[model samples]
Target: MKKIVIAPDKFKGSLSGIEFCNAVERGIKKQIENVTIVKLPLADGGDGTVDALKFYTGGKLIAAAVHDPLLRPIQARYLYAENEMLAFIEMAEASGVRLLKNNELNPLETSTYGTGELILDAINRGAKHILLGIGGSATNDAGMGMACALGFRFFDAENNLLEGRGKDLNRLTTIDTSMVNTELRNIKFEVACDVDNPLFGPKGAAPVYAPQKGATKRVVEELDAGLRNFNEKVETQFGKNLQNIAGAGAAGGLGAGCVLFLNAELKSGTELIKSIANFDEQVKDADWIVTGEGKFDEQTFSGKVIKGVLDSRTNQQLAVFCGLSELTAEQIAAHKIDYLAEIIQQASGVEDSIKNAGKYLEEAAAQFAANGIVSK
Candidate 1:
């Protein structure tokens, strides 16, 4: 039997990676007989990381009570593999920007304290290896909120305690880490960080990402100053200079904080997730490989699932099924894509494609199998 590997990322607001795989599998089965299909739903260390890992690895999903970005009570989940004593956490589960409304988008007030609680929960459950996906954050606290949850305390110039918000960064005068959860020192922490922005400066967290998290032009300047001040304080207290580090600005400076507080290493989110999924080994001998994202555009090559699949290809035939294709034929040819299909082209319009994405996707897959695969 021929082997087909279906690996895809989520279509953003539409279908999930797993749903994409299922729809493609169903379509493939309808057109092809005596074929083995391997479904590997993947994520790039963002909102769907835990769900993808859990679906692909059959890991246990563990939920805990935690605070949202606004410090409101909520339940969040992480993926745990007991035998490996590994916990995979998507920080967005607790402190994602999507959790807040347009009016509530103040980065100065948002907190990653909830994310820290999830990490602590995993630690308490005996996680020896913790993979933290620190993407889509709503805060600009420089991971101060997270550290506080792990028992780090911040003090102001007047010796007043701080709550670790973006507003507290400039006021930060000292850090107390003596009470941090001792277990954190024993466990290995690997942070999924793909960006290369430094902790503070023109391309840093505040200038580039603060606006998305609800900062105004004036507030952006304030956050930038705060990040700079916090970096100096961190270097003085921890003897680590995080401002110059690559990926230090990721997750509103949580990347730098992970390094300073948990001694964590920052890694490429796409590469890290692929390594965890054993993606290369799974697709090595496959006869056909299928992958995609929401839009087949330049961003698809930016450490996304399709890029991982294309980079790992050998002699296997590849097909891409996306919601829309923005890549010109020349670009597609440059990337060496064997075939491409867009659901928007198959449906009545963009709205119809999104409304019945799975249906159109299934039809596209079946047609691909019949015309593209069978014709070969």
Candidate 2:
């Protein structure tokens, strides 16, 4: 009996990580009998982290009342693991760009208030460790809402409480940490992030990502100015300049916010997932390994799940690898992946490719299992 591990990240709009594993399993079983398949979902601290953790922790999903990026009331779900007293949070659930209509993409007016509400709920539920995945954020409020929820007061130059939006960050002049949730002081916060852009500058939050969230030239400029002001104010209050910190601009500056305000430790999402998932132990005796994501471009080599999988394999001498949708021959060759295939190549059109992604994946897995001979 061959032991195979199928670990894959969510295929974005097409398939979830679990779904991908199932598809792969179906394919493998068709080609080989009595094959042991281990499914481990993966995420890069972005949209699918909570779901991935749910598989590893057997956590319960809890729904909470929160606000959207525009401060609209909404309900979002997060995961809680009673055994570990851990809460898994995906920032996208509360402030993702997907929540807004195409015409309503205004980064300046958006806020991360709902994300804060989720965190508060986790704390209230007696969670001692928070696994915060910061990705796909619709707001660039530098974590003001989260800070507010934890008892930090943001004030304007006139000494009035600042209202909302990243634009209001410019007016922020004071931060009162006295009311900060005492529970947070004793809790562990592990922030899963990947980007290294600073909080404010040419390559910072506003200029680089705010436009994608619906900022125009005018709004980007204003938001940039506002973020600069907020950074200066934060420096005055905390004696630290977060403007140039790597990963500070992740999740519309949520990375900086968590670090400066909540004392959260920032780490690569891939590393965090590997540790929490115990991927090494899972793959220790596996005969073959499969890993991929939506797109396997040059980016996959840099801090993505594929790289984590490769790194976790202690005995690199073993023939271990997987397949992906969009990988160049050269890129695949560089990784030394044992079996390489794609679903899009076999589909008729874009819609069909997406719709039949699972089927295609299954077919690819079957073919690989039949012909993917690994030499030790």
Candidate 3:
């Protein structure tokens, strides 16, 4: 029997990684008999990281009361594995830009306090190890809001207590950790980060990502200045130069905050997830490996699940399935993609493709199996 591994990331707004795997498996089984299929759903420590890890570890999702980016009360969930004392916290659960309306996407006014609440909740419940996925953040406060939620207090030069927000960063003079949870010191935090942007510079978080979160050019400059101020304060107190750390600008400087405050280690999201899933051992002997994402572009080769899969494959023929392909023919050839399946080809348009992604994916997988898979 031919062994096939179906490893795919979540198709944002359409299907979960596991759902994608199921759809592909159903389609492939219909076209091939006498084949063993392994469904290995994957994530890059972003939106669906918790779900993917939960599926692998049989963990439970725990909901907690938390604040949103705007400091509004909301409920967010994280994956908790009791036996392992591990918690997978996707920062976007509370501070994600998707939670706000387009008109409400103001990075300067946003806060990551909600994300801190999730972390504290996990820690209170005996989570000794935290895998934090810091992506899709809405705030540009350098994690001041998150740190505040964990009992850190910010003060201005006048000794006025300040609320942690992007607008408050420029006024930050001191950080008080007197009330911080003592348990936090004993916990281990591993941040899943992919980008290499520094905390403060032309390519920093504010200038590069704040505009996407609805920042005007002026607001972007202000946010960048605030980040620099925050970094200066951190350097004065902690003696760590956060501005130069690669990936320090991720999630609106939450990456740097996790490192300095939580003593977290930053790691490639894809590689971290792959290690947890034992990806290499599982696919080392497979005859074919099928991988996919919502959009196949330059980012797909940069610390994404598809990239991790490609790097791990020894002799397996690779087939890529995506909602849309942005790669040039030369890029495809360079990556050695044996078979390319696009769900868009099986649908009417982008909207129709998204609305009926499972159906389209099934059809695409079926087409690949019938035409791309060769008899051994």
Candidate 4:
């Protein structure tokens, strides 16, 4: 029997990581009989982080009431893998932009408090190591709200409690860490992040990402100034500046808060996924690899899942095909990808394309499987 590994990240707003693997498995089995299928669901520290691990670990989901990005009451879930005593939390589930309405898209007003609540809940559950996925955040508050939830205090110029939004950080004069949960000091945190943008500057959180969360030009400027001010205050009070720290801008400075307040170690999201999925072991005897995402552009070459899959393989001549929204022949050539198939090109609209994505994926996989034998 030939061994085949069906590993893929979530399709984002379409299929979960497990579902993607199942779909791929079905397609592969249709063409190859007596094939051993290994499903390794993957994530890039975003919405599906918890689900990806849950599929592999058979973890229990614990739900808790937490605040949304806009400070609204909402329910979020975290996973606990009993065997490893590990807890997985997706920051986006608790404090992400998707939870907000159009009018509620205010970077200056949103908070990461809900994410903190989830962390505390995980700690109380006796998780020795917490894997935090830092992506798809809606706020630029420098994670002050999360710190507050974890027992840190932010005081304004008048020594009054600072409340709400990234803009409020402009008035921050001190950071009081005296009330932080001492229990958290012993726990290990692994922050999964891909981007390396720093805390506050041109390439920082506010300036680079605030606009995506509905910040106007003026709002972006205000939020940028606020983050800069917060950095200065933290430096003055804690004798540490998070400015220019790589991945510090992830989840709108949630990464920085994890590093500074939670003592977390940051790692590349794709690298972590590759390690957990055992890509090296799986690819060692594979005949070919099929990988993709929603889009395959120049960005795909920059430490994305596809890049990780390619790097794991020792055979440079191994067959690889990418399924994407659209593709330029030149772009595919630059990445050294063997073949490209555009699913969106065959659909009518965005909604239709997403609705039929699974079917299209199956078709593409079947084609790849058939081609593999012919090429051999």
TM-score of each: 0.93, 0.90, 0.91, 0.88
Residue-wise C-alpha lDDT for candidate 3, range 264-373, written one tens digit per residue: 99998888888888999999889899999999999888899899899899889999989999999999999999999888988889999999999988988888888887
Whole-model lDDT for model 3 versus the true structure?
0.91
The whole-model lDDT of each prediction reads 0.90, 0.83, 0.91, 0.77
Model 1 residue runs over 4 Å out of place are none
Q: After superposition, how far is residue 172 of candidate 2 from its true place, in Å?
A: 1.6
- Can you write out model 1's per-residue Cα lDDT over 1-376, one digit (the tens) per residue? 7899999988888898899999999998899988999998888888667768777567799999999999999999889988788899888889999898999999989889999999999999989999999888999999999999999999999999999889999899999877888898899999998899999999999999999999999999999999999989878877788987999999899999999988999987777778887989999999899998888899889878788888889999999999999999999999989989999998889888998999999999999999988888
Residue 357, model 1: lDDT of: 96
What is the Cα-based lDDT of residue 327 in candidate 4?
A: 48
Local accuracy of candidate 4 as per-residue lDDT tens digits, 202-255:
898878999999899898888888878877877877777888578988777877
- Stronger candidate by TM-score (3 vs 4): 3
Give the lDDT ranking, best first: 3, 1, 2, 4
Task: Name the best candidate (by lDDT).
Answer: 3
Best candidate, TM-score-wise? 1
Q: What are the RMSD figures for all models against the true structure?
A: 2.0, 2.6, 2.2, 2.8
Better of 1 and 3 by lDDT: 3
- Candidate 3 residue spans exceeding 4 A from truth: 348-352
Number of clashes recorded per candidate: 0, 1, 0, 1
